[model samples]
Target: MASENVKLEPLGPNKTGPNRIQDDGIDDYDPHLHREVESPTTNAETLIHLLKGCLGTGILALPEAFKYSGMANGIVSTFLIGLLCTYCLHVLVRAQYVICKKLKVALLTYPESMKIACEIGPTCLRRFAPYAPAITNFFLIFYQLGICCVYIVFVGKNIKAVADEYTTNDISLTLYILMFFVPFVAIICIKNLKLLAPFSILANLITLVTFGVVGYYVCQNLPPFSSLPSFGTLFNYPLYFGTTLFSLQAVGVVIALENNMATPKQFRGAFGVLNIGMTLVTIIYVGMAMMGYWKYGDKIESSITLNFPPGDVLAKVIRIMYSIAIYISYGLQGYVPVQIIWSNYMAKSLDNSSRKSLYEYMLRIGCVVLTFLLAITVPLLGLFISLVGAFCLSALGIAFPAIIELCAYWPDRLGPGRWILWKDIGLIIVGIVGLCAGSYSCIYEIVRSLASGQT
Candidate 1:
């Protein structure tokens, strides 16, 4: 759908409207808060920003996800899941425009859209309208924090792998965690999006090169066809789903990215940045999953990066490259919660304080420490990634978007025989099923791993 064509009828006095929106047409969320800095992201910059945001440590784990679904199922499943995710993103963007048009507002954050959608939907959903924004923020906070923890584990595991080869004195993961903790804190403290953009660009370049190098190694010394399974056990599908979902979906930051665009109107077009970026991301992920599995088969480690030979200097360089890239990414992912918490609750109280800068820096540093401690405690990279994906992202990625679409169009545009209505319902069902199955599988694996002393 074209972004320009997403117009809706203006609402009457009965429906909730943004009567108190800022004169400049931006909503500062709370009356006490000052207007947010105007966004300057061009389409190209937004594209790069999103590409960096979506692809990360999770992409490296695709080979392991392939291990669950096998070659035959993995290819089809990855494509289907990727398509579903893209469509859900479309639904969310469209819903944002629809809600904006009806409410007579210029912009809406993801949580604000959620609240509006719920309030406008059928009477049954209206009761829960007040809680929608909070629920969305809760998921966004934990999801972003979970990603930070994954980055910590990713960096620690790779560094430990390299350190084990050269040094006889085995270094504990905790020490490695401490080693990177300070730098991570330093990175997240850079709060301005423009300042962080350069780092994200560098991170994306490193990831692209890392993908190319990874592909080169996989191309050489490929596994025999006989060694690869065409179809995997049914029980492993959920685990596969969780990892793929984690790797592909970036629902938590959808509105943040769009609202920050130089022209937010371009964000929902047929050839929009979201579609183009997600399309490229899917192709790269599918290629990595299929090729990595072809090279390593069932023998693939939890991360394909770990499968590289220890003594190869190039391999070590790639590991270090990826560690730096993922470390940079920690700041980008953490920025979501940082904005939510700091702006809404902390910023007002601290902004007027004489020690404002000190407290703000401390808050950022403390958040980094929180994620580090969790990463050090759990340390199971693959299992932890899947757990967060299933439990948190499933809702953000699938169920919530579908719900948003339904709520945005219900009883009027989607009354009867409307394909959009049925389509949304189907998507909701798919999302709910994935959420249940993936959650069960990930939790079970975590429990089993704990019992076996794997974590």
Candidate 2:
């Protein structure tokens, strides 16, 4: 799939003619026809990319997530969350198409879509239109950076786990994280998305192999359904909510993937790329969470890979190989924040400078260093995942899209009796509640862990 480098065309006058009109009054402005992709991806390729986006280090955390929500509740809740996320994605994409027709533009990025939606929305929100992009970008940057931090901690912990088995010396997780600083900086500096494509392909292969091995281990000697609890406490559900949200929602990449597709309209229907990919993703997540939790019961680690027996060479290889996969993924995850920061904020200021390239490299290094510092500072993988999910994904995945939809279709045509309005309001409420409750739960746990002098 193409990267976010696809340029957004300026809004032109709305076209109106027999050619531009469909049977319905809606304009026949097909964004796909206008998209100038150098190498557009087929539906199958786009589906694969979508799967990769949703399945990441987050998948390894689902088993731990299930530990908090329990067996039956986790399974049901994960499916529901996945369904909600997929619906939100559909709405966001649909809203973009609507706004794109109104604006007569080929495509828009997430933040760009938000900005335009607000600009053309109701009068009450028109004043805030200028700030919409900034707000959306803020959440996107936070979520992307959080993923990078998770990657850092994930890679460090797995590497530390494997190394601990080999020698008597005890190396700190922080040291392992620090050791990757140079390598992380080196890889991230590559900049070009094409240059990183091979690494991404390799990582995906390794991840699939790792998952296969993990599935084999977890499936063998499985515990009965009665072995684990049917449900967990109220407070723990927020942890489950956050982790599942983190695991299932790939809001950041949804627009880019859709924009780069050869058949963009095929991305949201019943049998389309979005539905098919997310269905598979949800099933894989549920299977992993249920099986991993059942196998380990209450003693499951934050990542399933950590649950593998230490004495086993195959387990060691799994850890090392999965870590390598995640290590490569760090660059891919970090690419978003770098693109947003550079293209939107920094590039303009340095457009005339002789050393613009030098400054861009510095920005890339700075981003890697920031995530490294954060990973070592917290290092609590579970809590960090929950916090990022609750705080960022809550807004990016659910709330923002609903808000954009409301603005995009305001004052008319919100379905019969304005059901769309009510529905969006409910979604916004759910997003807000999840944001507050889940974030508070994760923060409280982090503080308690720190207060008790636990790393």
Candidate 3:
């Protein structure tokens, strides 16, 4: 009976323990008694927030990715990747809900889910359980910081490109990074996401407008279909994998978005926010990649934004608007890691006092500064984005979630004649291959380009 309890226990947050689950999957303890902050996000707001997170600089680089995969492969592969990502997110969210029901908690963040999964996994897998939170945090921190770095590079490079075209002042990328640093820090300091919701909406509107302007340009003088290959060479598929993966990877923030929803149940319904948002995002990605590739062919720059005519007013406006949109979007991405560190690592170590509050402020500012410095040093935006995509997205988006599903459904599915095990194993293998191949290719290209004295 005791052994049975051990195998059939309800997973605890950040630990393995046999929590007593009621018939309704609720614990006897009341969570509201201890709850502090009220999460204030409606279904519509959650959908909008998710859309904002999904649309980022990766979409701007898709034409170059299409340059590698060609238009036909680009469309099919992108939709497939989006579907896979959504499936992984669904697995992760379902696991969270199961654990939440058992633990009698209203929410479980991404890392907490990792810890819980490890806790409930097989006895053989339990030995390394203590490292789960750290492992998850490490990936989450690096990925979020990588995004901030990408934003810094995106803002700095585009702003410098536009400014250099119009004026004789050839400003350094570092200067633009510095100029944006203060505002970046200011935005990140807004602890409550509700406060930043309005900015997210505005940023998304700007992104939509920029997309329209880009489409207009793409339609002006479309290149012949024969000029661009219908299918690219096999060697370039890894690059396509990395860029498409990067463009759609928002796994880091899915739990955060769902947890904050006023009606979290609606997040995963038939026409839920997740499905709706991903479908729309996939459509937009396909449209942009197809149009951008058809227009520019192999001449597409790392960022399609760079391909815009320098003197055109609408082009200039789009560039500026994109910079600002990405700048605002940076805070939303950074918020997850900051919250993780503060809640998991720092807050517990410090007491409830004015100095602790001050420390939080300093920590947020320091993170922004670190990312800015890193971006300024290695500002190869496209390659860096691909590297992060291949590494982080592979782990967070594919590998971990598949493992979580395995752990969540262990004994029943672990026995003979279970297809779940095989499916997860396959996903894990695919994810590992993608991570290794994509990362290696991206790094090799970056090194070769640098050696040949190219950006």
Candidate 4:
């Protein structure tokens, strides 16, 4: 195993120790200071990865939900949700960079990244601030897998639709699965994020092409779009906001990028770039979804393929490209969370005397099995994702950051609230409100949908 692997050279970040990361936990919970191998990533590279990973694939299919929700409500929901997500992304970035800076200064391991920012406790969460990154990582892998499966379905559908003219059946479902297996397997073996940088750049270009095609088509048919639906269509906003939360979810990406930074010191830079890019992408995304909905009306499906009329060659080609690009995007974006969950799972193996490689395989298999269970049992993928993400990831990524930061920054405000320090208390209240409003709306819709048997 050692010889088959190229020795992991010090890319940039220092190693915490060569003691083979205590996966099975023979070591104490105390932070390890030996420098860890810096993952092959830069602030700039992380920015690109975040954009391609978060914005590229989901934006294509999300308009389907908007169409279901109706135009007026759809656009409104998109903006409001976008605003909430923007805030969540901002807080997660600020919290992570703040925590990382303290960890580096203390010469602590990344797992203990929160120790300097918060008081330690017996639980791994308090000791490690588990929910923030660790819990979010779990759901992120699930989100990646869900989006990947959606991509695969879209790829097969688009190809079959177009290719059917050329051959009786140019691509079969079996062939599609078999075809993706090689590339998917190839991606898994690529070592780390930096090696895949070129692919990330190409994927972003593909997204731009998708943007060009979708934007041009919608703008060209503006009159037709407005006439399709009007103000009475606003009722579907709740569910639309609920389901499409998938698009705004990037807190896990924030944490992973921070972790993988070659120089943790550069988190401020990476985060700055990440926020700027996301702002621009959000504007483009809302526009695309709105225009796509307005142009196609309620006839759209979750993958954008349905909106492209059967006879238009350009639309057909766009569908095919969008599907394939999303497939690659999901697979690539999925890898980080996969590594993250695996890392935490392996932190057990690395930290313990009983550490074995088999745990790695088990973790992967476990996730696949769980995804299958949820997908089969749950009627709506969007609702299922939002449920898990809101209760878990959103809490960890958004709420926890605000809580931890407030606690760390303003200790006096931690006392019994109403009578306590007003200034800091107000900030906490606003954070809680945003968290509750955003999370409540999502969770409420999921529950309501499930009750009505819609999800």
Candidate 5:
């Protein structure tokens, strides 16, 4: 007999063993036992990666997010969004585990999980299983490309800030973006993950130092709370929703991190890596938003780094360092979409071609150019962040997970009294509303900015 802890017991003999699943319908499969990761990541290592994933360009935009929602509202709403995002992440992972156990698979990517869940779900959804992976990949690819575009704008704007100090001539942000094109292409062309690992490490370290310096500046000369509004106008709340969602949700990498764990089971539960990491992330985000907003008040820039005094030598150094950090991250961020486009769609066609390597390099350069064009077209960082967050993450981070959970559990196993069903429904509704409202607000802002002759 299988252990009591096992959710499903296999029929006949050959039970109570790792990676053992009989021909019968029953399954005593434990995903953890079956995993064959050659170099599994420890819990602490996974936590660090989680932190690095969540703490990207989004963190720098939270204060501006606060600018949209007001300090008090921003604090409260950000925490709530963090909670929601965390819960959704838990939902997705739990569903993945359940589906993996049923399928007797050691691991499944986000799209794979969605596809398998839909295949085994309620009768109505089984037919849609074929399309799930493509849809999921669509969101994943779009979100990653959106991130690359943000990095482009972020690096360009920071470099522009530093150069504006040295020269009185007004250089277009487009020119600065163009200046870094070759370097961006050079870094993106490096296909070896091992080579890129060092750059990722350096970027994380630089980000930490940048945040520390930013904290120092924001902490000094704090403004009184009475000067700022407790709640912003309703018109701007969607922008806040989008930015906070963008900042708090790192759904793209959650499954990847969980799948690579040395002990995958330690990724969830009360004190699991997910909870602890997200708690610290939420706290950091809230602290940055509150402090940055309080310090700069209405004068806060899209990135808190920009709000730093330009004349200060330290501020210039910080800007340059952060620009370098984000520039490095562009390659890391761009890697995802490139892989999805090439391996999933293009590589099969060129399997026997001698110039396959040549095509891949061209694809990489093409992605850089695509993001460059997008960055130059809508150079506004805050609006672009909001749009991407609202449009892409809303679906990937929130709605799709809820839908996946619903399908994975199906007609039964939806918790006592079907509470999970209702809860998932609520999440799906929230995601949809956030997507629509946030996207609208961002587009409106972009159009208004254009009309006002602002970049």
Candidate 6:
């Protein structure tokens, strides 16, 4: 908690909204005012917190995604999409930083971040600014729930194997996963976002473990991956496309953290960290996907662990760890959007004449309920990725920041900097084009899968 005397600085009318505090320069921000919110840990703690939360349940499904996209193409696409995602997150970071600095109020909450930004310029722009976070949060809750459910399912399957009991096998795996929500709900009940930081750090470490586990098997199975050079896309391409997108989804998670960072000035260092982390992820994706598919060829399941001999203790152990890791990651991921909605609902309830205190509680219960429902209905893994990525993330992750940046800092502000403006507008335009076109292809593929009666 910050000191009550600590105040947010304000900006000119061009920056702050009509309702905002007038700038007097009297209330300078103590940039370190919120340091108590974090432990003595430095920006590395923040960076890892951002990266690990982003990587969540996606790790379990990434190899499967690669199989959907194809081999060479998927490997290539992983790096390409990661870079593009890094760019999108960078835009959001810039937008949030620029807006927050202008407003002088720290983005202590999600809505506070956006509201402060929109105050920088026009009214209509302000109105639209909140959409991205809202939509992102809506999808994230389900995404997180799905991951946790997967973890629960993994537990049941393993426990059933060991116990040699519970003979009733008629229940759906998804339903069994729902049963764990009683416990998961208890976990989500905790209110502090920063409190999850240590867990997120563990998630990143688990990610490293998963990477190493996969890498070890990959290296030992080197003969199969020798086919990389001969790999051509036309046929093997769709085999691994999905993982490319999965590899980069964490970058969107970065945007959620970027808004909450204590020091906006440290953004450059954060972006550098982000790029390096994504590069590592890309390499791991390429290594795992190329090796797994090349090894098994047509017999490969979406997940390599599945394709491994079932009774092998090593493989089972890896699968268990992998599943647990995804499960924890998703649980953390769910918190990102829930916190945003919870914050906004709390902020608005200040004058909405409603059950203000209860809204926060409602947010927790709603997350558990929604996630449980999703796990049951949309049991298919492919469908989950499509729904989360194309419908939710495409606009929120790809299109929204570009729109905000163009609207917030364009046309006049460049001051004869048409060259720079055109360059950015071109990049933004490219991202928008990619969003529409790529999302169409992904949705088309998902629709085709549904039509074909495939999961």
Candidate maximizing TM-score: 2
Candidate 2 ranges beyond 4 A from true positions = 1-25
Displacement of the residue 8 alpha carbon in candidate 4, Å: 22
lDDT of each: 0.80, 0.86, 0.79, 0.53, 0.86, 0.54
Off by over 4 Å in 4: 1-47, 97-137, 163-186, 192-195, 222-236, 256-275, 347-393, 413-455
Residue lDDT tens for model 2, 247-302: 99998778878888888889998999999999999999999889999999999999
Residue 438, candidate 4: alpha-carbon lDDT: 46
lDDT (Cα, tens digit) per residue for candidate 6, span 1-455: 11212234553343345355333334455333422344233457556655555554455456556555656666777777777777777776666544444456554333344444454444566676556445445545444454544444444444333222336465545555655677667667767767766776665676677667666664565455544444444433332333345445654456544434555356445456566666666665566666766666555554455565556676666666665555455555556556556554455556674776576767777877776665554445544554455444555555556555554453345436556446556765654555555556555665676577664
Residues forming the 10-long window of minimal summed lDDT in candidate 5:
1-10
Clashes of 5: 0
Q: Write model 1 residue lDDT over 1-455, tens digit each, in one string.
A: 01111222233333353332112324333311211335468899889878877778888998899989988889899899888888888889787767675665555677777787887776787788889978987888898899999999999999988888989997888788789987998889887768876776777788889988898889997767677888888888889988999999988556667766767667778898988988899998999888888998877877798998889998899999889988888887787787777776687887669998888888898889899888987888888888788878788989889888888886567756877778877887878888798889888888788688884
Error of 6 at 220 (Å): 4.1
Question: Which candidate, 4 or 6, would have the higher TM-score against the true structure?
Answer: 6
TM accuracy, model 4: 0.67
Pitting candidate 2 against candidate 3, the one with the higher TM-score is 2
Candidate achieving higher lDDT, 2 or 4: 2
Per-residue lDDT of 103 in model 1: 64
Q: Give me the displacement of residue 327 in model 1, in angstroms.
A: 1.3
Tens digits of per-residue lDDT for model 4, 32-131: 2332544457767877766765674457667766755667666776677666666655554554333333233323222233333444212333455534
Q: How do the residues 1-455 of candidate 5 rate in per-residue lDDT, one tens digit apiece?
A: 01112223333353422234332325566877977777889999999989998999899998988888988889999999999999999999998777666666666777777776676666777788889879888988889999999999999999999999989899999999999999999999999878988888888899999999998899887877799988898989999998998998998778888877888889997899999999999999999889999999888998889999989999999999999999888888898998888877899899999999999999999999999999999999999999999999899999989988887677667889999889988998999999999999999999999789787
- Any runs in candidate 3 off by more than 4 Å, and if so which? 1-42, 102-104, 192-195, 352-354, 413-416
